[model samples]
Structures are given as C-alpha cells and as structure tokens.
Target: MTLAFDSAGLGPGFADPVFDSQSVFRSVLNAVAYPGAIERLAHRPGAPEGLDPAMASVVLTLCDLDTPIWSDAALSSEAVSTYLRFHCGAPLVAAAADARFGLIGDAAAMPRLDAFAMGDERYPDRSTTLVVTVPSLTEGPQRQWSGPGILRRRTVAVAGLPDWFWADWALNQGLYPLGVDVLFACGDAVMGLPRGITVKE
Candidate 1:
C-alpha cells in the first residue's frame, strides 16, 4: 500500500531519498560491474502490493522523468502503475521495445530478450534495462557466466526464470553492445546480467 503504511504515513519511497538512492545506485553499479555477484539492497522502500523492495529501490534509483517504462502483466496493476508514475515520473509505454526501462514481476512469463529495445548500432547505450523480479537469487541450478566485469567465471543460481530466458540470453549476449541489460531481483537482493556476460548452460 503506502510507506510507513503506518498511522503517520511515512510515505512511499526511500525514507531518505538522497542517501538511500545513492546507496541503491551504487549497489546497482556494483552488481552490473561484477556479473553473477549478488548484491543485497540496504534500503527497503515502501511499494505497492505486487512490487517488492528490490524492484522498488531500483525503479526509484534508475527510472526518471526522461525514461519510458514498460511492465509485464504481473506488475501492471493499477497500484503498481500509480506507484511508478508518482515516484519516477516516467511515461509508461505500451510495448516493451519502446521502453528504456522494463519491469517484470513474473520472470517466468516475461517476453524474450529480443522483445525489448536493443539499442541500434550507433547508439547501443539506448537499449532497455530490465528489472526482473524472481523468487530467489541464491537457490536453484547455477549457470556460469564470464565477461567484462568478471575476471574469469562466476556461478549464479537465480530461481523462477523460465528455461527460455537463458536460451534467449545467449542470443542477447551475442548482440554484445546492442542488447538489453538485466537485473534479477529477489527479496532485497539483485544480480546483474549485463550484455557482455556470456552464460554457459
């Protein structure tokens, strides 16, 4: 519902916006820099019924007035839409490919990596960044990934994503600088899966 959600009505975002957002932003950067590494969110913000703290923290930190956002059915509730609009002031796009930021509360049923915007050759940085909410980041079958941030290889076990995700990921990674980047969140933890990282089944 609301933050503090208590009688006082603390509000619906980081208690301390500046400090909290910086912390979460740093965590996000670190997660992306070191693929497969799990980063726990220190700031737990109040969010809608279907949204979790990790996803909330991410949206509050990354999405802004200039970005276009898209969400799957699992996160397309009126409450969630209201929360995103109120907190981020970002426009909600109808198609995933039109969004600069995509939010998925149901990773199992989410669209393929190709469904989202893959920045064109010249402006590869314009690609969409997907915030995917999963069941757990510490439990499940592990996949080995190696890339820019990783020294050699790192193993990660993110539970709940469908098998097709990994398959689609291979193609995504193959696109290198042209594909979408992903942040896998569960509870208060987030794991990054940038475009450079290659995951071996």
Candidate 2:
C-alpha cells in the first residue's frame, strides 16, 4: 500500500528554527512569569490560513512530538493539522482531556474551561495549557487580577472572550494547582493566566 502526502495549503515554519524557537520561548516565559503583562512575540511563524500568527508561534515554540494538542472546530482544518505536524511534530488529539495543549480559535464559542485536563493532585504539571485567540489584548472590559507572579492587583482588558469566561475562570481557579493555564493570543501580543491567578470584573 502507498500513502500520498498533500502540501497544497502548507505554510513556512520558523526561518531559523532553533534561534527563533528560543526567542519565542523566552517571550512566553516572561508572559507566564508576569501573569497579566502582555508580551510581544517578535517573530512570525507564517502560519497556515486558519491559524493566528501568535498562536502559531506558541505552538512552534512550546510543542513537540511529546505534546498532544487539541483544537476547536474553527482551527481544526487539515492545513493546520498538517502544518503543526510538519513544523512542531505535535500530535492532534480528539479529546481535550488528553491534550497537553488546547487551542481555541473562536473564544466566543469556546468550550467550558472544565472540559480540559485539570491534571491530578499528585502531578499538577500534567495539566493542559490553553492558547486562545482573541480580537485584541488591550481593548475590552477591564478586570482586576492578583496572585502569584503579581505583586499587586493589576487591571487588564481583553476582547473576544465568551460572556461567561470570567465566571468559568473563577471556578477553574477554585481548583487550585490542578486547573489548566491559559495563554491569550491577539495578533502579535500574548498574555498568560496561570492556574493560581485570581481574576474579577
């Protein structure tokens, strides 16, 4: 038997794979370390048609053959799956609970936060890291945030999230160290919201 490969809608990966991944990794690290602070990713991943540049960059930087990724319907195109498999070598999984990373292309229609892997009490690091695409990182209803990585409460505004997002987030936070971490991608900007963080309108 023979298998045919399709490259019709594939896009370019990192220009300098090693160096580019390192740079983006540092930016992501800072975002997670600073919580509410927005970090800019300088390199563009030349992602496929349906993927966001920032989201694509995160996948390229963090995922590998060992990571299982799950994507919402809007981002689950063949082009995207092929692009990620070729570039990041990450496997796409059907269930969010089995994914180490989850991508939400349409935040407004995103699934409930509890649907993802919340890890276990003995190994919280096993939880999923959700990368959600949003309209703008700086133009929405403001919310107050405080917790580890934050010295004091900070106000942040993010556009394109679902109406019950914050409420769901609060419930997720109640799970303590077992809940998933979130990364918001808006254009070239990215922000992190670790499990321990507190968010309020």
Candidate 3:
C-alpha cells in the first residue's frame, strides 16, 4: 500500500511526538490487562496518513534495538522501515518466527496464528506478538470473547478479519504455552487477544 502522511499538526519532522510514545505504552498496558476489549488512543505518531494510528503507536512502543520486526507486504515501504530503524532501532527480520514482533498490513492475507513462534510452557511470554492493521474496528462480524481479562464472555467485532482467522486463533489457543498473542489496530482503536483468550465464531 502506498502511504501518504499528513504532518500538518505534527510539524515538519519524521519523528513521532514524545506524547505519542507515552500514550502508546500506557494504552498497551491497559490492553494486556483488559484483553479483547477495545481502547482508543490519541496522537498516532510515526504513522503515515491513512495508516492506522494504533499500528503506529505499537511500532513505537514495542519495537527497539533488542527486538526484530517482520512486516507484511503492504507495510514494507522503505520509508516505514527506515523510520522504524532510525527511531526504534529495531532490526527487520525476513522470517516470521525469527521476529519478536510481526506487523500485518493486510488482515485478509495474514498467516495462520500457528505460523508464528509460540512460547513454550516454561516460557509462554517468549511467543511473538502480531500487530494487525484493519480498516475499521467498529464494523465487522462479531465474535464472543472469554478469557482472564474478559467479564462473563463479551461480544466484540474486529473489522477486516478473514473468515478463518477465528478458527486459526482457536487452534492456536489449543496449543496453550505455544501460541502467539495478537493485537488488532484500527485507526486509533486497539484490542489485544492474548494467547489464553478463547474466541468463538
């Protein structure tokens, strides 16, 4: 995808505002705690125009020199990669399993959840994190979510998800200690689906 950025409010600089960093970290913490619930954020830094704000926020907060990131074909822009490398100091990896974090620009084309690295029983936290960018968070087919962070099985919808996404997610969850955690980003809204969550079609 060709990304066009509007930096009118941000001034003329490639760097995302410092406030964006703080907001992203705080929001992600809440997401991990709440799981499967959507949280809205402001000041989507490091994103080009038309790109999801939450996606930019995540790339800024989670990626660093110690992490490896893999991007889907749509998000494989030279500008995007350069910005991430220059600001976050993260290394870009070619393989999904080798990456600590993966960015999926096209939700329809996302790989099966099982394709990525799943943490072992001894270290469940070692699994990879997937960041998926969708068209919108509010409109789509709904799914039932029940897990540690959920309250009595809540109903939610994530736009741009493929028909088999939930099925793949279920299979991944069955793997227990060996499954990747997924984060969905639409505009400035985000929702986390940890490895433990149960998603029903």
CA deviation > 4 Å runs, candidate 1: 1-11
Error of 1 at 132 (Å): 0.4
Question: In each prediction, how many residue pairs overlap at the backbone (N, C-alpha, C within less than 3 A)?
Answer: 0, 0, 1
Better of 1 and 2 by TM-score: 2
Candidate 1's residue-wise lDDT over 1-201, tens digit each? 765522232237889999999999999999998989999989979987889789999999999999999999998787888788888889999999999999998888998889999999899999999999999887878888888999888888889888888888899998887999999988898989999889986
What TM-score should be assigned to candidate 3? 0.87
Q: Could you say which candidate leads in TM-score?
A: 2
Per-residue lDDT of model 2, residues 1-201, tens digit only: 998877776888889888988999999999999998999998878888879999999999999999999999999888888899998889999999999999999999999998999999899999999999999988999999999989889899988999999998999999997899999998898999999999988
lDDT of each: 0.89, 0.92, 0.80
Measured with C-alpha atoms, the lDDT of residue 83 in candidate 3 is: 65
The CA lDDT at 188 in model 1 is: 90
- TM-score of every model versus the real structure: 0.93, 0.96, 0.87
Using TM-score as the measure, what is the rank order of every candidate, best first?
2, 1, 3
